[model samples]
Target: MNSFFHDENVALYRKLIAENESNPSRDEDRHAMLLTLLAEETAKAKQLPRLPDAW
Candidate 1:
């Protein structure tokens, strides 16, 4: 694998933290966003080709 392919996931982690926030004041919105993000990630993963064991 190349280093370029392992770019930092700063945006992804930030979104995950924001979605997982439990301030009670935004529970509904947060849960909805979480579900949307989960679906998006799943779709993206499904579209990628499988890698060999060496990876």
Candidate 2:
């Protein structure tokens, strides 16, 4: 529940959003990046044991 983790997640989420928005046609590169970000977030969430209250 720290600002650092919150900021990091927000940044990642923003990147995903930007990537998606930049390519509304579902480009392969965009999809792959989104999936990679999702997987990374999932792994981080799982490894954290407990998610931040703010998240």
Count clashing pairs, candidate 2.
0
For residue 10, model 1's alpha carbon misses the true position, in angstroms, by: 15
Model 1 segments more than 4 A misplaced: 1-26
TM-score of candidate 1 to 2 decimals: 0.49
1-55, model 1: which lDDT tens digit per residue? 2322222233464466565674546667666766676566555555656666675
Clashing pairs in 1: none
lDDT of each: 0.55, 0.68
- Say what the RMSD of model 1 is: 5.2
Scanning candidate 2 in windows of ten residues, the lowest lDDT window is 46-55
Error of 2 at 28 (Å): 1.1
